[model samples]
Target chain A: MNIYFFKISTLLYFLATMVYSVYLILLKDDLLRWASRTVLLGFVIHTLAFLSRYVEAGYTPVTNLHESLSFFAWMIIGVLLIAGLRYRIKMLGSFLTPIALILMLFALALPKEILPLAPVLRSFWHPFHVIFAFLGNAFFTLAFCCGVMYLIQEHQLKSKRMGAIGKRLPSLKVLDDLNYYSLKFGFPLLTLGIITGAVWAEYAWGRYWGWDPKETWSLITWFLYAALLHQRLTVGWRGRKAALMAILGFIAVLFTFLGVNLLLPGLHAYSNW
Target chain B: MKEKLNLGLKLNMEIIVIGLNHKTAPINIRERLAFQDSEIEEALRRIRSIPSIRETMILSTCNRVEIYATSKDIEKAVQELKQFLSEIHRFPLERFERNLYLLIGEEAVRHIFRVASSLDSMVVGEPQILGQIKEAYQRANESKASGVILHRLLHRAFHVAKRVRTETKISNHAVSVSSVAVELAQRIFGTLEDRVVFLVGAGEMIELAARHLVSGGVKKILVTNRTYERALTLAREFQGEAFPFGEMSVGLKKADIVISATNSPEPILTSEQMIRVMKERKHRPIFFIDIADPRDIEPEVGDLENVYLYNIDDLQKVALENLKDREKEAERAEGIVREEVERFVRWYQSLEVTPTIVALRKKFEEIRVRELEKMLSLHPELTEKERKSLEAMTSAIINKILHEPITHLKEKDEEAMADFYIDALQTLFQLPQSSEVAKEEEDARI
Candidate 1:
């Protein structure tokens, strides 16, 4: 049942992506409403799928490549829906829906069997760790979208070519503010995620500190975002510089989430496939 | 009966437009003819009193003075309107006669639609003409100078204008230098609310640019000039703060947007000064608009990481590009106007008494012939004379039943009352509507 709901949600997300693409080209308000509504519906069904999977697997489902990737996509869409309520940036979906769809497709291609929970993963802190980590990554995803928009708008202004694409984008100040908001929220969630992982590691492996690949990469990603936040607060590194830094930090996030898991060997390499 | 109905359609009242625009007349002549707001009611009343004119509206702006009216005699109406313009302005008819244009029938309708859509504007896609036209229309309506025809025509014109606005990109770009400057400021700063605008000198162009910024919601204005007294005078006019020339760097550090139009021979704001200000302001993106002749801000300042600089030539280039874009979009806008004109003309024709009466007669005749044939066929023993008598009797009864309503519909002297009667008759008898009339007209024309 959970798989069926997941498949249905993936299809709905695909529909949303197509709608958003049309909205971007036509710049129609009705199409944007349709796109946002479709995303909301898909998010609802996706949440049900997650809950159903938790019931079926008797555990939090972030234990493998497939489950974690799907969870990340779900969190991204959830964050986008929440952000949509706060900001009138309709074009954000045009940038975000594709990313979410690609993540869903990647998850769909991986293994789907409900394996038994490993002994090391049977701790109370595991679910909190995964949820905090994915939520932080979701916020960073929003920052990355805002960063890209800021660069495009800034370039359009600097070059003095206020064309259709430039007119459709939100102003530079709005994008920069969104980027700052994402950093302010994402950095703390990320810190808590790391702390929770450390506490869970001590319970599971009898050690709080480990030179694991995921751990080291996560630390590097955390430091990048921390530096960006600090500079944004003190030196007021904003506009183009802040946009570029946000982009760079998200790349670090992607590497820590995917690259380290796939390419490096570690105790946290639960995706045996 | 068919011939009479066709004649009625031919004698339908025509819409006539007569005017002189910027293209046709010089500013002196236009000024002479333009109607002030207080004088518009009197002008409309006098124009409506013309014997041949039925309903009227006057649109008077700096660029053009046009009178829109419906009349039975187009030529007489046109002559009277011209004579009224000459007499009211105390100008000789021969002086501006060559500048006048006379448009009648479908041409007049198309002209009004084009004007309302801004396709006929001095700047093709400027939005001011529509508001001016709406205000003129309101004044005419309030004075009761416009009746059914002008009312319907103006409303349709408004609809066409709205369609052109949304369906085309005609009005999306800012095509003036000051507007372009404001647009760039908005793109950099999002909302201009609480943003500070610093003026380097009290030049006309700089003052115009500052006025546009203030209207765009910039709350604070700072003025600086080589002479403190001049700066103080300009600042007081803007309800802002003035600074001495030596203190410009302080204003620059606090400002989000700066407009420099100094008469200095050399650049006053170099890259070094801007770099220090950027540090002091913490790199919160600042925009510089340099409209000065010798350029008050150095060109290298534009290359700074978060600094956006546009000079007079750069602003002009963007405005020119936007104007070209509007011209391209104007073609699409004209197509929309053409489509709407055809639609409005169709609706206008459908309200004619001839078509409705003709359709009603045709419907009654068809029903009478069908019933008579059924009765005659039922009695195969009936004589030829008997069948003819029955047909005549049915025709007489049908004509008696239709006579009162058709006469009342034709007797309506008010166009609005006539329209209501036609609409009620069409609904009561389920008459074939506008499409058939439009098709028949198209066939007749071909």
Candidate 2:
């Protein structure tokens, strides 16, 4: 919680991700391995930093958008590492690590001068709402990675620029399968997050759903991913088309988390940094 | 100079390739050499009977017949294979030797890689050769003729072939002998929609030839098989007619191009039969291609005017020409194979030194233990905790002492000093030495 270690780890994570991105371009799998190790090391340091913050603050770091987003990013890294380990996809960390580093940077940039969580945020629903939202978003983020890989691979196959990494990348079929399953896993968690957030709102603010910017954007994001899963299963849409739709849904999730929280006024505006 | 390590594993044994092809001794030789899927065990038995053959696998495709084997005595293996061929085909080996080409060591490795990658295939970059190689390996594996070295070499060759197909443009286009026939049809007839293709049999080769013609815009395909129902079904796919065996000559006259593949005891289409068709067409050149065993088209038809009688051998020549065009890409693929081969060989070499290194470490530990026991006897008055600490200190000291030497021995460059170190260590310790250990150490450096 020296916060300095987290900052340094975040910087290292950024550097590692960048190195891995270049490694992919250059086909340096050894360097990619090094980058993976570095990011995993950075995650360890980042975890220590977060634990220190939890001890200092004496509660779960989900009081405001800044704390929640920081935790959101930390959980995303955990999610990514787990997914990467399970799938044995090394290059994916190159993309997702940058997202984690950026989110952490944004966390550091938040006004740390403010006091702890307000009295209104002190509820059991608060932890559930934030935890579910962050985890659901993490799954969606992985779906996003699969989608991006799918599109790149599909385009390469179509235009036939299929160079080294293009050849090394998994087939469009595999990427589509990853995207489909990621969304399938993500949708219900997102629904739970939304339901919890709604209940928490009703308990604290005397309202269940206010159609606030964050709430509205979250619903839109939910609907998009929902439509994606629906269209894939019922309509038999898959491959590049499904990948593109999942990507679009993640973009909506991004807007709900970042863009709406920052750019628009809402009932949940107090949480914005 | 590196020490003489057990470089035998890395050593490329001669690939004793003894089998007839389209170019070599004709269909008679090739068919005689061809082993059926079930009869491969018998073929392996006959192959193993050949002197000095360490490993063997028969890859008999329609275009070429090849035997891949590892042999220390290349000449003896070749002679044995030659005798086997003579015994099987009942033809003198001297007649086919001129057409048979022998590749040893690196050339053999390169040839196998090319064959597996489809570069040596009748169709450049065709995927069928990979499957054929896999089938050959499977048969060899099941029969227990292939050894560990061959198993690794072949699997690595397959991996290399896959890498080439994925990383290069080697397999981007069709260049099969049948594909050339298709190409020629497209060039001459403009479109297959107006042209008629008369397929003379229900054989797979003839069906493939007909498929090429059909894809080339052949409007009508008249099929004449021994079985009229089978011919009718084939013709129906292309919206054409199925004529009876008796009406094959009539079907030939109707067909602008004829592709004949049959297993007849005698020539099905004679010069006299073709002469009548030539007179009916007023000397219109009928492109007749015979892709068959014993040849469905009469060889004497070449004497007749306005008759283009081309056989499987001739088509193979065209296929070879197409193969030549891809030699540049094949060279690039060869470079990849060479790199992978070296890497695999190096990895195998490293595996050899590991056991030796472990043994050497054990010897050092034995000496360390003896020294520790002597020290404990000298300091018997030391306290229990003090004695325990001394043991830890001594083990750490031994580890520190051995670390540098062990590290140096494990270095990639250690093969250069392998002989000197092994000899010096053997002399200093009065240890029993083996040439295999030194040879293994030398192989690891490369």
Candidate 3:
């Protein structure tokens, strides 16, 4: 049942991505509305899928590669829907929806069978750590999209070429503000996720500070965002510099989330696929 | 049958448009001929009071002055309207007569449509002409100077203008230098609200761009000029702060958008100076509009991380490009105007009493001829002369029977009543309905 719902939501997200792509080209308000509504519907069904998965597994669903990727995509869409309610940036979805769709597609390609939770994975801190970490990643994904848009728009303005794409993009101030907001929210969540992971590590392994590949990469990603946020608050770093940093920070996020597990043997790499 | 029907009676009342536009006249001549807003109602009344003119409306704008009227004699009405213009403005007839264009009937209708749709504007597809025309029409309506023909014609003109606006991209892009500046600024800042504008000189072009920004919702304006007094005066006008020319960099530091138009011989704001200012402003985006001939800002400032600089030539190029775009869309707008003109002409033709009368007579004549032919066949021995006499007698009888109602339909007085009579006669006699007329009648009812 959870698989069916997940497949349906992935299809809806695909449809929403296609609509947003056309909306970017046509620049029609009605198409944007339709795209946003489709995304909201997809997010709702995706939540249902997550809840069913949690029920079927009798635990949180971030236990393997498939469940984690799916949860990450779901978190991204959930953050996007909440952000949509707050901001009037119509073209943000045109950039962000495709990322979520790609993540869902990657999740769908992985194994779907539910398995019993391993004894070591069973802990109260595990779900809280995964949730906080994935939520942080989701907000960083938003910042990354805003950063890319800011670069395109800023380049167009700097070059004094008011092309079609430049006209559709939001202002530099708005994109920068969104980036800052994402950082403000994501940074705290990231700090919490790190703390919760440490607490869970003590219970699962025996030491609170293990320099496993995932743990080391997560620290590196944390330091990158920390430096960005520090500079933003101190020297008033914004516009191109800030946008570039946000984009760079998201790259570190991707590596910490996926790269550490795929290439390196880590204590967290229990996918066994 | 078509020719015979057309020859039954003449439709003497014709739509005549007489005017001079920017293309045909110099500004001096156009100004002399233009009707002031307060005097327009009087001018409309005076024109409508002419014996030949039945209904009239006058449209006078900065670019054109046009008189749209329905008249029995086009030549006489055109001559009188020209005379009226000379008398009202107290200008000599011979001076501006050559600039006048006289369009009659369908040509006049098409010209009015084109004008209302902004196709005939100096800057084609500018929206101000439509609003001007609507105001002119309202004055005509208020003064009771325009009757059925002008009323319907102006309504159709407004409709055509609306269609052109929606169905074409003619008015989408800004075509003037000042407007294009604002457009680029909006593209940069999204909304101009709470954004500060710095004006760095005192000139007409600078003032125009500043006014556009003010209307665009810029939060504050900072004025700096070579003469501190001039800066203070301009600043007072915009309700903004005034800074001496020496403090321009100070104003630049706070400004999100700067428009500089000074008569300086060399670049005033160099890249090195702007680079310093960029840091002071923390590299926030700043738009520089250099309207001066010798550029006020250095060309290299545009290369700065977040500074957008556009000189006079660059702004003109964008405006010219937008003009070219409007021209491309103007073709589609012209097609819309052409289609609407045809529809309006059909409705106008339906207003003519001659066509319906001719149709009614032809219907009677057809029946008369059919019955006469059957009788002649029965009386095979009848002579050719007798058949000719019989045909003449039947035609005479038909004319006698149709004379009263035809005359009533042809009545020039009370045009609204005439329209009613024409519709009723067409429906009562089951005459062939012009589809356009039917649609118009349905629209009228609605």
Candidate 4:
């Protein structure tokens, strides 16, 4: 039943991705609303599936490869839904929906089997760390989307080719501010996530910092974002530079989350599923 | 029969329009012929009194003063309209005769559709022409000058205008310098709602540009002129501050966008001066619009990292680009207007057809009734039930025989072919011109 929910959720994400792709080609009001609704429905089914897995496995369900990818996909949708409600930027869905769908599809390709929890995974700090990391990554994902929109809009403004395709993008200033906002909220959550992981590292491995592959990459990702935020806040660096930094920040985050766990060998990479 | 057919041909309704527009005449002549709002009702009243005119409407916009009317005598109607224009405006008829262009029938209908859709405007795809035509239609309707033909035609014009607007991108881009500035501001800032704009000089062009920016929702406005009192008055009108000309750099630092239209011979702000202001403002983006003929800002200022300076010629280039875009879109708008004209003409030609078919059937029924009465009197010995069946059989035969001809008359593709068919029917069956004859009767009674 839980797998059925996950399959349905993944199917909805696929359909929404198709609609959003069509919307990118030709912007329409109905297509956008339908895509958002599809994302929301997929989000609900995904939440239900996670809860069912938690009830059966007696854990938060982020301990496996499939769970981690699925959780990342869910967080992307959760953050998008909130941003979509607040910003109401119609074209944002046209960019982000495909990303969410591909993430979920890759998750579904992995084994769906829920294994017994490891003894070391049993700790209070573990859930907080994973939760905050997912939230931070989710916002960074949105900031990445805004950064792409900002560059496109800025190019349109500078080029003076005020035509149909140029009209589809949001204003450069709006996209820049949204990029700043996501970074502002996501940075603190990332800090809390890193702090929680450090506190939990002491409980599980008898160390405050392990210099593990995931840990080292996460610190690099954190520093990348710190530079981005600091340049934006202090130097008032904006437009092309701010947008490029957001894009780079998200790349580092992607490496920290997926590349470190799946490829590099480390203590934290043991639960590769 | 030939004489009666000639009478029916003379009674046929015709639509005609005679006017001089921007294309046909200079602005001086167009303004001279233009009608004031107060004079429209009186003009309509006098024009309707002309012997040949049946329905009349006048569209007197700045670009054109067109009189649209339907009548039986197209030549006489045109002559009457010409005389009416000359008499009312007291302008010599010979002076404007070369400028006036005349269209009749389907050509006139197409002209109206083009006008209503703004394709006939000086600036093609402008929206104001449609509104002006609507107001003219409303005035005609209220004055009871427009009748059946005009009511249908003007309503079709409005519908065509709506289709052109929704289906075409003709009005999508700004074509003027001031509007281009507003558009550029929107492209840069995403919105002008909370941005500050500073006016460097009080030239008329700058005021026009400032008006466009203010309406676009610029948060604050600062007016600076060499004459401080003039600046104060203009600022009071805009509900903004009148800053000192000595503190232009201070004003520039506070501004997000600046419009300069000064007549100054020397460059007001060079690239070096702007770089200093950029430092003071932490390198926030600034836009400069130099709309004066003698440019206000140094051209080198545009090379600054976050400063976008557009001179008058550059703005004109952008406006030209936008105009080209609109011209491309106008192809689609023209297609819409053509489609609408075809549909309206089809419906209008169909209007005359149904009446002709009905009148032909009426003529046939009259003959059948007369013959039936004569036969019934001759067969006085027959039973009532037999008489009823006989009458029904004759009626069915008449309906069957007349159906093909009626269908043939109603199915004509071209107006000329329809007229030929209508003329044939009137000659073969002598279908009386009921409406025209009734109008004559009313004329006699009055």
Better of 1 and 4 by TM-score: 1
**Off by more than 4 A, model 3:** A1-8, A47-70, A112-121, A271-273, B1-14, B38-42, B45-51, B86-92, B142-152, B199-208, B223-239, B242-249, B261-266, B346-446
Clashes of each: 0, 9, 0, 0
Q: Could you give the CAPRI-style class of model 4?
A: acceptable
The residue pairs that clash in candidate 1, if any, are none
lDDT of 3 by residue, A112-139 (tens): 8998889888999999999999999999
Per-residue accuracy of model 2 over B235-300 as CA lDDT, tens digit each: 887788889988887887778788888789789988887777766664544667888888877788
Native A-B interface contacts kept, per candidate? 0.90, 0.00, 0.53, 0.45
- Residue B142's lDDT within candidate 1 is 96
Candidate that would win on TM-score:
1
lDDT of candidate 3 at residue B368, scale 0 to 100: 99
Question: Which one wins by TM-score: 2 or 4?
Answer: 4
| TM value for model 1 | 0.90
| Weakest ten-residue segment in model 2 chain A by summed lDDT | A155-164
Candidate 2 wrongly placed segments (more than 4 Å): A1-49, A64-66, A78-95, A108-115, A149-188, A191-195, A198-212, A219-245, A265-273, B1-27, B34-89, B102-329, B336-446
Best-performing candidate as measured by lDDT: 1
